[model samples]
Target: MKQDLRAVIIDDETNAREALSNLLRLVCPEVEICGEAKNADLGIEVIKEQKPNLVFLDIQMPGKSGFDLLASFEKVDFGIIFTTAYQEFAIRAFRFSAIDYLLKPIDPDELQAAVEKYKSQTAGLNPQQIQILQQQLDTPGTVRLVNRQKNDNQRIALPTAEGIHFVQMTDIIQCESLGSYTKFHLIKGPAIVVSRLLKEYEEILDNYYFFRVHQSNIINLEHIKRYVKGDGGQVWMSDNTEIEVSRRRKEEFLSLLSDFYVNSGKLK
Candidate 1:
């Protein structure tokens, strides 16, 4: 028989906590509401006392934020499903970190899905990946990752069968879709294969100069060594690998290339 997951809700809002608790009771029968807290400090106390299997954490709190709560622990044993009303940048950060989260005014179905995901996946969360999420959240200015300075040390967490691989975003040359899995080709090491769809990454990397020229391939604009024009055209990457561009996306790809070069002062 499957075991019940003891979960604690930690949010600044009493109503939010109550609503989540009520929803858990209504939908997820395998999850037990072990404890609840209104802020990070009390949350820390409750967590230590309860020693829950899962925590439904809110990103924004009165005193200490959700990240602050996690920072207090040297190593997190419980699973986290962040509940946030934060902006798009935070959402992107979460995805890049390979962390699970639910949006505010949460849907019952999504909550159930998150709980199931936690149950099936491994227990330990990567600290460096969490740090990457926090750094991206703290970064100011435009959300377009391409606009950011190249040396900003941006990283991403790629979850594979063995464990999670944390790699610098700049190190990625391209991503190729292999059915449900995506293969990440890097600049310095062997490619890492993740058990995730290409579209999931395409959405996040699109803002960071990573373009999906073909359905199966997403290449970094910065790593394009040369382009050969044809019906759809083809681009040679810095690693000397050739990738074809989709016919329908030809114009858009060329336009983006023009902008990329102009912005970098290479085509002034």
Candidate 2:
């Protein structure tokens, strides 16, 4: 028998809080909704008391933001799955931290995926690494970045020929995989760096904004113009660049597109 994981929902919206809790109960019985809080203040207090294994955090909240709450805690013993309608700031945060999150209105499949990933990562992670990650959570300047250097696997301070290009998370048009490297196309840049593999970038970028539309391409939802119908169908970027959408990923890509447009206002 598997051990049941305890969780807390920390969202300002009561409806969203209850909805997520209900979904967890119905879809992922392994996750127990130990508590729920409407704001960061109460949420922090509940977190201290419950000491849950995981937290479903909301980026935007009344008074203090979720980022602020994370900063306030001296140590984050629990894994975080940020659920937000917005993507900009949250994407930046995820880029700096190897944190996992889901976008709203929460998808059951995404939630299940996050939980499974958390289980896999935490199951074998060294306590020293966890401590280092906790220290990173406490530090303000430490942000998540895709470390591409062969040296030490440390977070990069500057973009190198080998380091990841700091494209404004919103400005990235699409990422194309070329064997071991990925070419990132941005809104204003003509140059593309053949850096780390597509799987590496996929793990680094916020899943809410970027989706693997094909085995070779990861398209930014904000930059997608439309999906043109064809023998295999193609995804059109805001810059009018077209990329093949794999047949297996078409359904998930369409779902992400619908969510992106419907929640466009939250992008700001």
Candidate 3:
């Protein structure tokens, strides 16, 4: 037998909190609502008192946002499921950080799915993952000025057999597909192999400087040392590894690289 999941709902809106509580009672009988709070300050108090296994946190509130509430804790021992009215960009950040979130006007199916995911996963979002999410949410500009702060802030969460690894996006040279698994070749460390499919990562990395030169390979444009031309050009990565660009994708890859150089001001 399993234990009931003790949960706390924290939202500024009374209706939102009530709605979520009622929905949980109906959809998730296994989840027990132990506490509720209207603001971050009261939320902190509720969490400390109840020490629930999970928290359904609303993103925007009167005094502090969900991110601010998380920052208050030195270590988050419980799981989190964020409730938000944010748009696509924030959704992308949540995906990139592997965090669980439900958009406003939450659908029952999605909420149930999120709960199932939480039950299956070993742990919830760690501090590093939260930081990555916050950073990605803060950065809205497509073309940002190069700086150490930006580089340090840009990280993605990779879940492996060992645990969830938070890595700087700039450190990744390329991603290689090994059947269902994806291996990350980094600039400063050994490759990290993740259980997820390559296509999933391709979608996330595409928003950054990554380009899929082949079906099995996605290279970071910043890590391209040289491009050797051929029927399908081969690019030498910063790791000194040569990767072949697919014949069908060669033209598009070149175009993207040219655009990258122009936009990045690296065309000297």
Candidate 4:
């Protein structure tokens, strides 16, 4: 049942850990507070000794950062829910990377959400996801995501009722807005609906060969079959879907497509 989830809090701040403990005690009764560590040295030791299922990690510590502690471990089998005050670019990176985090001063609702994600996930954050996090932290704008499910029995975690959807970025044709939700049209399968807005994906897929052609749709340039003629015209996706290209995005889309083709040496 994955019940009685053992957890350890690894933060440099005493008050921060105390506050988290209080919140967990109030909201998440299933989680057992097994241990607490002041810094990375003690954090590493705590995990080695206690062997908890979850670790509430803080990004900034005294000597070795949270990242450094993660790097020290060869394989991290426990789920990590980061508590960080890193704003703007870092947060954007986490959104695109699909890594769970709670910004400080932590929100109770957000903490509960993170715990829910932990319950759903069978294995914790692997080295690859941690690497992606580090890369995103290093290069803020690059939203290159790494998923383990291209060949293995892994799944890309999308915020939808269907839960983990096994999808590759290249296979996604376009995303259409459906009021509050977004529908993902794929090249080889039926469209999958997610409980997230188009704008959320727009930002996540920004540097990942995706562009907003209209207020309604964001198309993958690699999967674009052809561009039909009109005032603003429409883009014909490989999946036989024709998405209207907004007048404002026409020139920009074309220019980027041109650049893409040239760079790939397909424009000759």
Q: What overall lDDT goes with each candidate model?
A: 0.86, 0.67, 0.84, 0.79
Which stretches of model 2 miss by more than 4 angstroms? 88-97, 123-268
Total backbone collisions, model 1:
0
Residue 174 of model 3, lDDT score: 90
RMSD list, candidates in order: 2.6, 13.2, 3.0, 5.1
Candidate 4 wrongly placed segments (more than 4 Å) = 60-63, 71-75, 116-123, 126-128, 142-167, 189-192, 255-268
Q: Distance from true position, residue 256, model 3, in Å?
A: 2.3
Candidates in order, TM-scores: namely: 0.88, 0.50, 0.86, 0.75
Which of the predicted structures, 1 or 3, would earn the higher TM-score when compared with the native? Answer: 1
> For model 4, how does the per-residue alpha-carbon lDDT over 90-145 read when each residue is reduced to its tens digit?
77667655678999899889899889878977665655556666766765444332
Say which candidate scores most in lDDT.
1
How far out, in Å, is residue 41 in model 2?
0.9
Per-prediction count of colliding residue pairs?
A: 0, 5, 0, 0
Worst 10 residues of 2 by lDDT: 142-151
Query: How high is the lDDT of residue 264 in model 4?
Result: 51
Stretches of candidate 1 above 4 Å error?
Answer: 1-4, 140-152, 265-268
